[model samples]
Target: MKNWIIIFIVSALVGFGAGYFIFQDKEEADGTNQTTTQEKESKQENVVKEESKDSNAPKTATTSDGGIFSEKGCISCHSVSALNIQGGATGPDLSKAYDNVEGKHGKPIKEFLKVPTSAVMSGVIEGNPLTDEEIEKIVEALKKAAEK
Candidate 1:
């Protein structure tokens, strides 16, 4: 009888200790989530203010970086922080992507941007092709960013 009681007490203590460890992480995660949400809200507010500054501005793509990229809709899927632009995460950052990246059809960045063989990019280019002037600017921008 005494041994059984000792075993039950030990088990209860172990269970309580395990429960404490598990529940503690959940509380920390909730706090972290709250902080993340607050950060996102703040960022959204800044974006709203920027947009409100130009109410008469043309509604372009998903992002408004106020450059050739935004005008050409590249900012919808790509961002070049080196060019001080913020865009969607659906595509890779083009900051230093001179020749380091490729297209779905195995073409380099320049070729891909010029022709856009990828199914997604094919449709995009079909709707709005990149002009030679715009392509020159983007390629030069990428080269400069990569050099840095």
Candidate 2:
């Protein structure tokens, strides 16, 4: 009877130990999965919020000619102080670009707008060439801003 009791106690301890380790491993796995799921949810929410905010924002710059500079993503690089517009400062302030293109570059603004041969502009316009109408409107807008 004594030997039987000892064997039963040993079996119970082994079972309990195995169950504890197995439960702990399962719990850890579930915790990792929950953390991963929460991270993914947070990222998705941020994306949705950004999209919503962008959709409600203005699509064009506040230029005289109603040029859609932001539509072409120019606002990501340049800013026009005359228009009271603030944008990324990666490129130059374009409030005086019209004057520079004509006076310094010694080329018609329209010609520069069409080809954009300058080092800084060529790369920006290469992949996304503007339409003649867009160039004309934007040039007019820039000219108006330069006058201010």
The TM-scores of all predictions, comma-separated, are 0.51, 0.55
lDDT (10s digit) by residue, model 1, range 22-114: 877665444543456356546655664586579674332233333566656566588777656666778888876776756335777778887
Query: What overall lDDT, based on C-alpha atoms, would model 2 receive against the true structure?
Result: 0.69
lDDT of each: 0.67, 0.69
- Lowest summed lDDT across 10 adjacent residues in model 1 is found at 57-66
Candidate 2 residue spans exceeding 4 A from truth? 1-67
lDDT value, candidate 1, whole model: 0.67
What's the distance in Å from true for residue 114, model 1? 2.1
Number of the top-ranking candidate, with lDDT as the measure: 2
Instruction: Return the clash pairs for model 1, or none.
Output: none
Please give the RMSD to the true structure for each candidate, in Å: 12.2, 18.0
